[model samples]
Target: MTNSTPLLEINDLSLSFTSYAQGLRQISTQVLKNLSLKLHAGEVFTIVGSSGSGKSLLAETILDILPKNAHVTGSIKLDGAPATCAALRKMRGRELLYVPQGVTNLDPLMKVGHQVCLRPEQKQYQEAAFKRLELSDAVTKLYPFELSGGMARRTLVSTALLGTPRIVIADEPTPGMTLDQARETLQLFRDMADKGAGVIVITHDLTLALEISDTIGVFYDGTIIEQAQKSQFTGLGEQLKQPFTRALWCALPQNEFSTPKHTGAAGHATSSASTASQPESKRAEANSQVIAGNEPENAHDAAATQASEHTGGAGDATSSASPASQPESAPAKDAAQHAAQHASVLEAKNVSFCYPGSKHCVLENINLEVHEGEIVGLFGGSGHGKSTLARVLAGQLPIKQGSITFDGQALNPHSCSPVQLIFQHPELALNPRWRMKRTLQEAWDVPQSLLDKAGIRDEWKERYPFELSGGELQRFCVVRALAPTTKILLCDEISTMLDAITQAHIWHLLLDHAKEHSMGMLVISHSEALLNRICTRVISIDALNNHANCIEDQ
Candidate 1:
């Protein structure tokens, strides 16, 4: 049923960006190198890779939306003919639909319904799309900022599904969605492929990709290292050809969940084989010690054990027990250890919140607490009050009633907040006009060591938020939140955009820092596997709020 000739094809495609160096000298960095792929009608092709691997950039290149400074050397063909910028522009919305990664792509000034419908004639189609996605009719009137991360993602999908397109490129489209919602979205993509449309999904969630992708391209560094049928990704990934691809398969939480030592600079999988062949006992020990989330003991007790190991005895500032290769200064270590003895608490007591002009309370009587040295996971269904609560706790939104306190005091709005919020959409959280360096410096004078630990490169500092991939921009956001003054960290789907390796790496870095500095964290995400791996304990938003009751009554 699939077409013999590809619907979209790329030949020897390469992309690079031009940026300034220390002086006025300009340098070009090739982020995407010799990438090539084909999408056939009636098939779903997925590109899986690490963060900053240029998967999203390929979509931008196809849409001809890359910035002016970008230099591209590639031939993009559609229906066996060249796809020039003008031709692509002509067919952009109707023939070549795109579901972008950033929810910021939605116009902040417009209502959701207007953005999706565009014209009065499209209202019916928009309604149908919303219904199919399980979005309430009321959501149509809300602005982009009013919607939760999951709702915003579904809205973007609705926009793409409104038109009959020859090709659909969705970039990390299902991150904030619930499991059912994510599966439904993928099923929609499959249905589109069955209807003779070529669908390309770029994602970090390999488990979801395996469920729907017909063909999978393993992306690394900048290019496609290997291409294999979905069936080939099997036990131990023996049927897979490339080491990195095999590593990715084995790294899934359902699989071995083994972390590779390192993915080499040249896109080689040097340590994947060893990781896949790790002994069961050794792997279990590593997982238990690193994540510390699966222990049957009390969550706080488990955290205490991890802290003791990470800090090498309580109140021992001179102890060389840090998990990071680069240790903190002696005075900083002394202060952190002293603070650990009397941990601060971030608490919300009988809190309630409702969006302005809305009759229903999104969060009602929500009581939650995160203690220093604790990583608490918050789980909830899409469009629920999870993000709303996070906003209130971070002081981004004022609570309608009750109180939120840190260390037994009210949050001060006049000065720099002790709490920092890392948003789900990195693009929206950042300034599009400023370079990456200025963005980080805007919060604090972030050390070079912290940037390196977060996988940010020096060359990237010169680029703007729009120039970097979503995952790459996310690193800057994470680093910005880790300022010295920050006490409580609120993460809203922070790792959803990253690959398995990068996700683990970031979590590992954060866990180490939090445990060492006695900082409390509230991590909000849809990945239960991730929560079980990193969090001390997972709590459902329904358990802490009356929003579910309000919905049932409705």
Candidate 2:
């Protein structure tokens, strides 16, 4: 802990949105619960949690950028003074600065240089920041639409870092960059903290965050359930007190690869101490299947048993298929024999693609195959054409050089698509005007079973895209893509925005459903660890793109 006073302090801050449903009925849904934290000068404080755990919402609330209908409560103090909406207006871009998640935050018409040079004198510092981030000087002359996804992300980050603010809040800042680049970018935040500025980073990559964050706060169900030193998350998570925290630690592919299950209720720490002694009946209590909204006979008891595997171990990140718990196994889902015998369901033969107007092709000579019951991981650095390949395979974009075949036939554009693509941003994929149920219904006739499997609540049907959390909306996206007609699931960085617990739950649900349905999948991601943990055989897209720039797993 540093001796410096907190530059930003949040005490029991809660936020909710007010909206009207149907014709004229008013509805208010609470999205954030009593969340509190303090960011001291010269410290990097990171908030870790699931997709809908209010991490981004927390940032929006702090910056006072939440939707107009959003209602906020509790005290928010900045520089030891009340940080009400009025006070925040004065500090929005000067004392307090925000770095949004994507380039969409960039003004489309504004020149990049103009965007970064909020103050004329800051241009030199901005250029320095851009160089540190490995950005080109020419990039400053382009418009928002002119830059690639990776370039846009770097611009957003550079724009934020150009300002010398007292406080910085960056949300999911490393999604589109390579591991080394992400590490370097985060180190800049740490350096800013070293210079007596407060930094708060919201991201899904806890492994990298551990290297820089001074303290970590675990957010779940719209609140912070646990907070601890960054040093506590090490060596099987023994020093960590929260069960979920330990579960997150173990869920990393480098760890035990087990994700602990939870009842989805707020409160309670996952204790190996309590679980080391629980009987089979108690452990059964742990597997009560909260993803389907089934609470155990004893909620607390379930938490202990479910998270107990981490008592002296790791990687219990929702360990549902382990023989120790779920003894029954499906023969067709077994990877050893089933995957070998299952017929090839989807194949891309020398597939290559380029954007409609661009002269250069992003992907070339990409040959990939997936059989029924096979989960293929496609991993690489951002801008390496992973997502472009997914688009081609899913028939969203036409292949320029090669052919894609599914179920021994060419894809039909008019009929129901055999390949379903789940994008990284669920909200963008969904219709802001339509309700969740309607969007899901367009893909499947009876979506109830799919909803239950994907852990989407019934109440979410009435909610619009903006009303739901990214994780919740993502659940809907998964259900829509895994419809009966889908032969191949193209998941393009789908869970990159989610937290560890939600990431595990989503993966568990997906793996279970895919195995049962014999649905083949191509999982596109930047995190090699995530692919290593969930995929049967991870393949590098670099093998297809023929690019010599990115590092990958074979």
Candidate 3:
């Protein structure tokens, strides 16, 4: 551990938000329960958790942004001084800087350079110099309206850094950034730590967090259930050593092991030991289900029984999936034909859209297409209208020029449906006061059979948005969108807020759903790996922006 004074400390902190309903006063909804942490100067700390785990509330409460009726308890100290909510508010933009998820954190109407130069005296930059750094000498003069996703992400980050805060709290800093951008931003944070600033990144991305975090804290059920060094978090056999942490440990990419100095070959040995601990029957079942489409329960039952028998023995299960365990099946010919037939479900021909307040077009002459049976990935620097494109495709926004067609039907600028856009943060999109059923019903006219088929049974109807997990709510939104019609889906940074494991699970579920419905989807993502795994073709909005630079890799 580094020998440094704690820059910020939270002691027994708790927070509750207000929930109001008919004929009743506001009811307190507890979010954080006695959360505590101490961050030293020149160090990086990450808080990892699932959605609705109160991780966000902790950050908000630290910034004193909890709702008016919300209750806060416990003491917050900054640089050894007693910190109060009033002090926190007064010191904002100086002592602490916050970068919220999505580029929307920056006001759309303001110029990117103007937003960054909010504290001209503190920033000590001439208007011209700032523009050059922000690449806004051209774009900054234009408004948030004209930037791309990468540009917007960079601008927001520059603004936060320009504030020169002692402690930076970033929520999903790399959510919608490409791999290179994500790596660059994390390196920037590492540089910040080197410069004697304390940085805290609150994210659900286990892989990114493991790659960057000096220390990791696991939050669950409104509590930090585990805290350990980065080595301890991902070291070999680390999972078997801590069964409670195993699920999370294995969920991340296996390549994130510490260097030889930390674990040496011991790490590999430990991983092997964990693998050897699994029963042969279970391994066979898992392989059969993946390669043969066997029932999950049947596979799990056989595996579990074998695992129980080999509970204390080390066995090699890699060879368990022998020929005998394989299902006797032929290739899926009709499935291939079905997938091919559903191709080109959504098409955008030279699509251009402009917001009411902006004089310049937000999305300039863009052409894109989504085929059935695969995810079409959208890539562009921020503010170039990735979300706007999603909205236009979903028929939520009207295009100033160009056309969008769904299933061979031309979509009028005024009337477009059959496409649904799931936002980066669905919780904000949902009405907190309404139950799931009311919200879904309001969005779609669902038949009884379809409702049952969607996996949203009667029990979930009464549950409000706040009652469901982030993944569940996101899935619910997709189901609701599909309820109206199931031709195509438009997802805009949908998994940006989810943890890696949950994000993976959601994507798998989406693929299954798409296959089941024989539908097409246009998915907007910053992660190239995700696109590579799911999309048939990757379209760059950057290339679209500069048509002369268009280059196809296929």
Candidate 4:
């Protein structure tokens, strides 16, 4: 790669970390192992890998942000000039920029305008970049604390553009926005590259990456194992003509595949035969009833009487009470006019919360209820404690004050159960150390038989997270979360990181599961479109803040 020819090139890069105990031995975690990549001017490079596969580490290394405790050995060349650690660090704020995974990069205390232009090196270019980034003028006066999740993302994009850097590195930039917003953001990145800047996106989202990237790089085991033009990888039938290729291909979509169709019939047949031979196979299932004959009423009465006597007659009725004295099963003969309503399933009362040391409340005076089988949405601005509130509802976090009751049972913060939280980013939620089966195994309540029935064929339980794509990781997360003792499902912005099609599939799966079991849910989200699709009722935090607004909207 020549100077002024290629924007950046990394050769034989390796990085790792060391850990030592007080008096015992030490340990090392090998991260990136001999990874290499190149970014040309006016091109978009996408890196796709599962969680804990060193994708983030590789991006951090390129940005010169790797931890000091880590050992890094690599040659990073920028525009053909040797990029030393000191040189990269010295020019970081001016010649290079990064847009991080979520909304945390922006300063909450400062107005978005001030935060966007906070870069000392890029201060002079802030005004022009703000306009170029398509940020609203009102954004300048509003702090990050007040912006919606989508708006916060726009601020970060504006901030990165302000630097006018030669290369822009974005890590999971579209994780919390609607489909339209995600597409538009990707278009912006494409436009940036069209103007000669190098753009590198680090994500597990293959569908999103395929849409905008010029070049695609697949990461496996801390290395860039494959690279090709985006066009070459998009056509599944064309891209994968071999068995191994097809396995990787199917894995990308969160589906399981063993090999390619073009492989010898014997190869395919052997795999199919193995699958057929497995015990508990339902593909050949018959709808035959397996039951014990019903017992007679007299027999049941006799058993009940004996059990009542042995248990000290808790089930015994008083001799003086006649059958007519018992309260009617229905309050009235024709009860429709005065039917008693069931109690609310769950409620949040007068809840107010703020992060530790923060003066502003993210959520305030919040009162809400979830009925037995309805799906509710907690829609709000970024950092407004949407995740925090979901955490509280799922008992992951304790409410600072207020109460939550489930089915008339007071919810004890320390003893909450039967509620599950499916995180938005699977990469963060999944354990890298566990194999696929072991991870799913922790859910326990999902019948092993049912799992086997729904199991994706291409999935290899032996493979680690590093070998999977974003969609694959997300599917595993879904399987793990839903395969449990589920009563209430608390979804924390799960769809924000997925592509439109994938999001639709996940939403449908959730709906189907809920319908099948009559489950209740409280879904936390920022995308109105997604809420409109899956939620029965959408409760905007802004509306709750003003009673008049709620009344007017209603």
Q: Highest TM-score: which candidate?
A: 1
Q: What digit string (tens of lDDT, one per residue) describes model 4 on residues 80-161?
A: 7898878888768677878876565677687766777765766666666556544556568776655555556667776666
lDDT-best of 1 and 2: 1
Quote each prediction's TM-score: 0.84, 0.81, 0.72, 0.59
Q: Considering TM-score, which of the candidate structures 2 and 4 is the better prediction for this target?
A: 2
Candidate models: Cα lDDT each: 0.77, 0.70, 0.61, 0.59
For model 2, residues 1-554, the per-residue Cα lDDT tens digits are: 45656788899889988888778899888888888888898889988876666788898988888878989999888878888778889888887889887545788889888888878889788989888987777777777755545566777888667667889999888876767788988998999889878999998889999999988888877898898987788798999887777877776555654445444542112222221121232332333232123554566633333222212111222443432244433542244343344455688888777666655677777788776666676766655677667778888888887888887788899999878899866766888899887897788875565555456677888878877776678778887887777767889878767666656656766766666566777887766665545554456666567842221110
Clashing pairs in 4: 3-79, 149-382, 175-496, 243-260, 256-458, 257-458
Candidate 2 whole-model C-alpha lDDT, 0 to 1? 0.70
lDDT of 3 by residue, 1-554 (tens): 35665899888988776766567765666767888889987878988865557776677777877557778888889987888767888778877888765454678788665777766584454343334333445555656645555565566666565645689888766665666666777767777777878989887766677677788887766867777676775454354344334545544423221111121111111222122222233433343343232345654444323212221111212343322233423344334444455455687888777667655666677877666554556766545567767877877788888888877888655643666677765665789899988887787776665444333446557678766655557656766776535667788878767654445445544654665665667778766545534543456666566532211110
The reply for model 4, stretches above 4 Å from the true place, is 1-4, 21-23, 108-111, 119-148, 233-238, 241-344, 347-405, 408-486, 495-519, 524-554
In candidate 2, clashing pairs total 13
Better of 1 and 3 by TM-score: 1
Model 1 Cα RMSD, 1 decimal: 6.4
